[model samples]
Target: QPTLRKLVGGSSAPQLPDDSVRQLLVEADATNELFKYCEGQGYSLFVAAQPCSYTTQVVAGMIYTVSMSTEPDPGTYYEIKIFKPLPHLEQKARVTEIRMAQR
Candidate 1:
């Protein structure tokens, strides 16, 4: 799995530090109920982060968007998105934006 920094930074954006990436992973790990559920159902979970504009609307500033996807199953998979505000911001909070679609 690519680090959150790498996923969000892409090829041109600024990269997040190692500590920041670790922090994001920790935060994402704390909310792994969906991952556990998927695993229980015999699916592998893949997670990565990306820059998201919709998160700005929810958080009022830059946000790290983490998405989890499962191995293909009948041309469908589960996806969950988590939003984390930028570290420089005073918010220092995390939010799970959405968890939907099954089967």
Candidate 2:
């Protein structure tokens, strides 16, 4: 999987650090912080991303997922696991489910 830094818009692939502080790792940490804040406020966080084929078997299919959660504190990490469907899974089916959930 590409590091979260790249997923969040880093310019280049991650590389070894010159010092103890790994910038890419720090960036990822910041992203998680932001997500936590959004979730805490009851925001519906949506991620519509084109994940690379390295992790996702399908190269072209875009992934969409909604997440919301409560946290214990700054250190506690919670995730909304959007299940990656099989290649045979229909995108329309997922969309329908999401729409129905909102109704």
The CA lDDT of each predicted structure is 0.45, 0.31
The residue-by-residue lDDT of candidate 1 on 1-103, one tens digit each, is 8565433433324343355544654666624656566667775556532222221223444454433334444335334344566657745444454444554
Global CA lDDT computed for model 2? 0.31
Return the lDDT, model 1, position 25: 46
lDDT of 2 at 31: 35
Candidate 2 structure quality by residue, lDDT tens digits, 51-100: 11111112234332222223323332232222234457653212211110
Off by over 4 Å in 1: 1-26, 36-59, 63-67, 89-95
Quote the positional error of residue 70 for candidate 2 in Å: 19
Residue pairs with clashing backbones, model 2: none
